[model samples]
Target: MTPEDRFPGPEHPDSGPRHQPDLDVLPYGTYYEPEPAGYAEAAYGSETYSGYGGARYLEQHWPATGQAHNVHDQQAAHPGYEPTLPDRPSPVHQGDDPPTIELGPPLAEPVPAYPYPAPGPDEPVGPLYVVGDVHGYLEELRAELRHQGLIDADGHWAAGRSRIWFLGDFTDRGPDGIGVIDLVMQLAAEAAAAGGYCRALMGNHELLFLGAARYGDEPVQSTAGTASFLAAWRLNGGQQHDLDRLEAHHISWLSRLPAIALEDGHLLLHSDTTAYLEYGESIPDVNDAVHDLLADEGVDEWWDCFRRFTKRFAFRGDAGPQAVHELLDAYGGSRVVHGHSPIPYLTGTVHADDGAPPHIPGPYIYADDLAVAMDGGVTMEGRLLVARLPI
Candidate 1:
């Protein structure tokens, strides 16, 4: 299969062969040379995943209105490494649900929320804010938060009593991925202190990075062939700095992040895939199942979680609305608010020549408005999306 098959961006689920346009943009939906056991990844066969998959940190800012940037070439040189790691585990069937999970955080008890004055019964609830896939662009995130008045000039939580959720994929592709995670961690604590809450949903890149870190060089079964987590991570834009800076706190926080979230009537998620339906019928069941899988030490189990969640665009084409209904039926929500798939891809505005996006860069509500796409393509001449909810 061509890269188009691997990352069919915004096409019909039953799409037949069409003339492949811009092989350069082949899988614009979202690679790296694998290195030894350290920072970079090893290459699998020629099954090209989208270059936009991993971390993409650049010293320069993402082009404000330039054409969608393409990864011109793979930078890291392949280096030989010790391959004496454990033999591959048998590929487990990619299932709808991960191993069944008991509810709650991996920790013994949930962190107690500090009490604040309860709003009088009639007081209006605060605004709800949602951020799209940050992709490790920390300063861009800061600027957007500041613009939204979610943070103060000093980058502290200034939005009080409001709920802000980050549709995940905090690390990878951008500089200071760990910095973004650190900031989010700090914000969650501060937001709670200020009577607001800052939360996140796990994205595919999160699973990809975590797998690379925890089970580097350990081979897992892939539909294509034998694949290793470390190599795939590197190919997907794993930055050495982010991996190096990963701390126990980051892992603990990310692991605790729910795979599915329902906020203010929107079913918040990372990717636009129906694979979430595979986890469980309800929100809590899905979240707990995700945490349980991440907590388990099994590499194949983790691979299943990573591989499945990475699937995207389940809510597009003719069956899109029905897919949305299925999710809404199982999980209570009027809409599915998501990131992972960029808005540019949805509107076919990617890689425009003049750098001007096809549509105004904001949320692209489609699938009969049953779904909302928030990734304004900030990583690719797109704006950092800081959208208010109840649309």
Candidate 2:
């Protein structure tokens, strides 16, 4: 299908004002409130998809040394570069006044619930939860996780034996990307000790950050003239503070994140694009291919991977359900859960620069109820979404 054919116009029913519902009492995904109309025409209109035509997808990939010694060698080769992490695990900055993010209000009315059955005595896993794109809004993230009973007032993992998967894009666009990463790393360790595990996926922004850190200003070929990883990252909301605080451990952690995961009958991915099919047919093969690429030193190949994953809206419009089916057929998930295209983008009500806040009810269920969008568009003054799965 043509690029324009993939998105719905304002006249389309999916682009109309959503039926806002009360969130606290409802089990998510029991019903669906379609995102606003005109989102396609408003968001992707006039954008070319051939080679990074839009600002959202305007990022190139990276080339890595593949070994610790090589990274150390690169640091030595480039003087005055010290990669050291902060000793503390808090997302709040030390000494400075805490960054204040005025989060948007949640849904208005009540919806039906779909509670999962309690695990049997032999059941090994606990409750499952998924987090959308954080985009460096550290405080908002903490508040949302706390609201979901995942983390406690102290910000430590309190959901014992419960699994939480962050759908990537942890850094950029807002304040304290590094702080967010540090917090996630800390949670992963703490959760494992508590029997519950906290893990993350690799988003396009991760690739952009890694490219900037590894390649710096090294030029890469782009359809929009010559581009570099650092330049693209900055253009796509890369924060100077994040870059300054980036350490070797952060790099290693980000580098090793998987592109996709299958959890509790949900296929979790960072982006909504069907480009994952290009990597491999099954989950392990796809992840292995991406990991292998990141472990190599091919700049263009890495850029291609990043660019492909950056593609969004593949599972939207009329063909959206079918697109989701393709992934499910190969990956063994009843639903595809992702975070890249923000919920507002699907709603078409709020832009990133809009002064007013956008009302995001909860995880958007679409694609004929076969896919769920977790991003609450935190970067656009929208809510940071943390949801329990099967919703």
Candidate 3:
């Protein structure tokens, strides 16, 4: 697709608004919100595939990756780049407040009086929750997580031993992305202390934000001819404030994040793609490879990681099931849970039947139940999904 095609507008004719796009930074990215008439197959991309369940085939190239280095090595190489994370991390400079983000409603599902069956004398307690994309919508995240009883009244981790995994995109687009990252970093420490853990999976946005901060406007060879990391990031809603506040610790944290994870027999990833296999045969190797790439200063290597990762919908069409099976077969997981491409994009509804932007009642299960999508379209006025795992 052409740049205009990827981000189409009415004046552009080729694209129409399909869903109220969930963008981290508001307004720059979305162009298609489907009218009552819906859309033709080719309009979405070079694809053809249907929705979940019995497929007429609504083709979904699909979801799209990062690089080299230890922090000490990076600091030595860059000169004058000292990033010692403060005990309390805060990067938003005073007087540089970002624009207010209008976060949407919280994602809620009917809960039983008790979340799980009461444990027998021998039963050990278990509660696993996965949060979808939080593109700098910190308050929304805090409110939504609190509702799930994960955090306490003071916004501290309170879920004792339950696991909470955040599927990346913690910064950029919306205001206070750094704040969100700070909270997660803090919670990870807190959660670990409580015998539970709050871990994160890396998302493409994390890659984009890092790239823009490091490379910014430097031309890189891409599948779509010459493009700069900065242009692509800003076009996709990279906020100036986030970029300004972007720090060494944030960069290091993002670089170290694993692209793939496993929990409760489910394969957790930030995007629904088979790209992880290219990094390594195993999860540890993949994370290591990405870390190495981030630490390195090569522009092309960074761009390659960024470009390869921008791909999405790999597991969505006639070949989607096989694609999923391949990832599972290689990764050793029965299911794939991911965030990146929002569900509204696949279903093509910005608004519900009631004229409200449709909220995902739950993670979208597709690819013959091999995958679950957690991005609830929070950036688009949809619910910010925080659902328990194995659903």
Candidate 4:
């Protein structure tokens, strides 16, 4: 079967062959080496799962825009394949009836309105704010940032000295992932020009995205059934438009993001897993280890790294507080702030039987008040959170 037959375009049934762009002219396309012999047969031989059948959120046929979406020449090699934006379902309306939730006993101590003592006149750093997972909800992100007075109406940094740290998962599962990254990159520059700074952590999706871009359809060993980086990405809400629009700069910026950070006594990370321990014991050591691993071209190592980051829910059971302490003891933080497992899932509130979206008011402080869950599950009709620390 042809590459086109395996990964068809929006108009697969009626589309005719189109012009292929010159690979040498596209910098991003260099990452797309041709698939190995019989790769299409080995990877996606069955007609049932050849295309978008196994994936969620991705439409069978997305309407095409006139612009060229296949910046990756590897996609261009497939004569009929053309990238398009995902047409995800709309979020549930706010007024809809919410599902029944079993309430647990209230926490022994409520989250303090003011956890930290007010800074005196001589304080050096500005107020610190951390953003939750932004899985391609660019507009929602903009609105929330504006609401927080971080950015102005024009989307420029308006907060003069207040720092912002984005807990990652910047791409995938929604529309305009590239646009979101572009905004963040732009904001980082803008924020630096001012007194403050904007930064991000490396999420699991970041690993998946990098793996898919660098390795493409190459086979990877998996505990699950047959898998490759590309297939796994698709199954886990990878957007065609994001991949198609990925540029060299975006790749560089994402690859260099730190896997973990410490800010204002908060241990900031992307996922809720302790897999980070495997990389390094110290903060710099961990980030350095992650960056070094990605710098190499070994596909199996990349896949393994991606898998390790994907583990979650470590801070969610009777041993949850102990789990939080494990990270704190190594990382030197009073509390852990994260954004991978959403609040709904952590609270057992994922299913909204009454047709309403899962309600996530703000950051969830749990794991014996040692960990903070910032992911509001934007991909699942929940909020995209941006919060101040010590909440």
lDDT of 4 by residue, 179-266 (tens): 9999999989876666568999998788888888887777676654445676666656677788888899999999999999999899
Candidate 4, position 301, lDDT: 85
Error of 2 at 285 (Å): 1.1
Off by over 4 Å in 2: 1-123, 351-355
Residue-level lDDT tens digits of model 2 in 1-391: 1111111111121211222121111111322222243432242332212222122221122111122222322221212222221121112123543232222212222211212233355657767878888877787778767655667778887666678899999887666789899999999987776666899999988988888778766667765556566655655566666777788899999999999999988999988777788889998898899888989867767766667667676666566777788888988989999998876555444422454455565677776678889887766555567777666
Instruction: Write the residue-wise lDDT of candidate 3 on 163-264 in tens digits.
Output: 888998886545678889999998888776666679998887888888877776667776556766665665455556676676888788888888888888
What pairs collide in candidate 2?
Answer: 10-38, 15-36, 15-37, 16-37, 21-109, 22-109, 22-110, 29-391, 36-347
Better of 2 and 4 by lDDT: 4
TM-score of 4: 0.71
In terms of lDDT, the best-performing candidate is 4
Compared with the true structure, what per-residue lDDT tens digits does model 1 show for residues 334-363?
999888876655555544456443332356
**For residue 98, what is the lDDT in candidate 1?**
27
| Deviation in Å, model 4, residue 267 alpha carbon | 0.3
Task: Give TM-scores for every candidate, taking all chains together and pairing residue i with residue i.
Answer: 0.71, 0.70, 0.69, 0.71
Error of 1 at 386 (Å): 0.8
